[model samples]
Target: MTSALPTRRFGGFLFDMDGTILSSIASAERAWTDWATRQGLDVDAFLPTIHGVQSVETIRRLNLPGIDPVAEAHALTEAEMLDVDDVVPIGGAAEFLAALPADRWAIVTSAPRRLAEVRLKAAGLPLPGVFVTAEDAERSKPAPDGFLLGAKRLGIAPEDCLAFEDAPAGIAAAEAAGMTVVVITETHGHAMDTAHATVTDYRDLAVEWDGASLKLDHRI
Candidate 1:
């Protein structure tokens, strides 16, 4: 027998762009791998670390000599913007998002605004009215800044929002912002090790506007 579906409700929703709503792993990995290789960094090790964080943060962490983190990050974004041939939405993501009230949802991503727009368009996803990009926050995921800003933009309290995320840093950021999180594991090769709710994708879920908030049900 199949397990019972889980249901939850919240005042609004905050979404992480890359791994949660869509999968840009191919384009992202290609860009990062090339950049890392050029920097004499271990591509295998570096690629894994690039997800869930801003490109500038990743480059800044390397402490590469004579490198401008901002400029290098911009270069990386330009490369990714051009390599969207494989960009696609997570399972049922486009439809799920279509059902949501535009004003009740916001996208909070570690990607810069232009890069975020490029990937979302490539994946054929709707552009949200409130998009909180990396440049919108002083710090990236694990800092709660971006998620917090998203909630603020939606006119909802941080604790009243439900966040969908796919990476460890993003999950942490949502929690820090005092919101419940639904982990999207569609792109992950392995099951996520998370205590919060988890789903393979939006296919198994249903969402409705309850006049006051969104009622989400995930029946696996």
Candidate 2:
């Protein structure tokens, strides 16, 4: 009852951090819940729209009285770094990444560089050779800027890249970047039909590198 992963060779890979390669929803939600309460915002109402986008976007949407989004983003990042609870790599995330050459993949995340480092280290994942964070772009996911920036930095054509994502915003962003996307449905619950394909986790996929290109194929 699941969709298949694309079985094509790509010039490079673009990965979204949270909910895709790393499972940090528990820690992220806790941080947001606590932060939301401090700002007198409802946690349940505020957390849903924030995933796959920068915390600054969430803060702006909350529009707290006279609160600066930049400062709030730092505060949230601090809390997340402090929490560290229940953060782990998604299934097969480590293996799939390890199979690729260092230069063949990059991380494009909605998290700030600081928070992204903390989470990646905490989750026992290696940092990408090329990393693009929220700090790299003024516009977040749903805009192509971050993914485009990542591909550019990787020296790979955006259209030749393949993206892996777990949220609708990330899917839109990858598509906007002129890349194809595979939805990792661990968080989005298989609802991301606009993706090229869907899988429950990296466990459902496999990667092969021939030094010149990478091929991602479905395992089952």
Candidate 3:
């Protein structure tokens, strides 16, 4: 009676926060859209492409012609600060994280430390054992720096980890780090075809860790 996929065991789990553990895309979109409107930019055209990228990277990729990227980044940060309450935990996210052994998982996000804390706290999710934020890496997602840092911190090999991501950038990051990736389809659209597996949400999956070996129960 559950929607689960084939399961695999791994040395550790790397998790993405925003759209993966928490349902904050609405808040993010609202913040970005409002900032775009205030700056006389096109929200409809830019918002979709910017999701899942770090704020600074999002600014660069939008290619806003002559706009000040620093100012735009600050504006987006301010907007997100103003709309932090819009964040919520994805269905069954708390239970899913809690079910796993603490040492077996970590959070690797493109969000800066403060923002990542705000969203995770607001969503009432347990903080991971290892948290690698944007400040921890020179390059963000699609670069593997974050995931590599996370695996290093966890004292685990990149190839022995499984990553849960909601964006192609995060998926690419994990893959680049030699980790398996499970994509969540709720936040990011189903446009990516790169994940090891795709799932509707954490609610449809089950996890078990027996000290030495991590086991994922596909029966949910």
Global lDDT scores for all candidate models: 0.90, 0.86, 0.80
Q: Output the number of the lDDT-best candidate.
A: 1
Q: In angstroms, what RMSD does candidate 1 have relative to the true structure?
A: 2.1
Off by over 4 Å in 2: 1-3
Residue-wise C-alpha lDDT for candidate 1, range 1-220, written one tens digit per residue: 0133336678898899999999999999988888888999988877888889999999999899999999999999999999999999999999899889989999999999999999999999999999999889988998999999999999999988999999999999999999988888889987777787777889878887878878888544
Residue 156 lDDT in model 2? 92
**What tens digits encode model 2's per-residue C-alpha lDDT throughout 115-201?**
899889998999999999988876999999999999999899999999988888988999999998887877664365452677778
Candidate 2: Cα lDDT at 5: 62
Q: How much does each candidate deviate from the true structure in C-alpha RMSD?
A: 2.1, 1.7, 2.5
Deviation of model 2 at 151, angstroms:
0.7
Error of 1 at 4 (Å): 8.2
Better of 1 and 3 by lDDT: 1
Candidate 1: worst-modelled 10 consecutive residues by lDDT: 1-10
Sorted by lDDT (best first), the order is 1, 2, 3
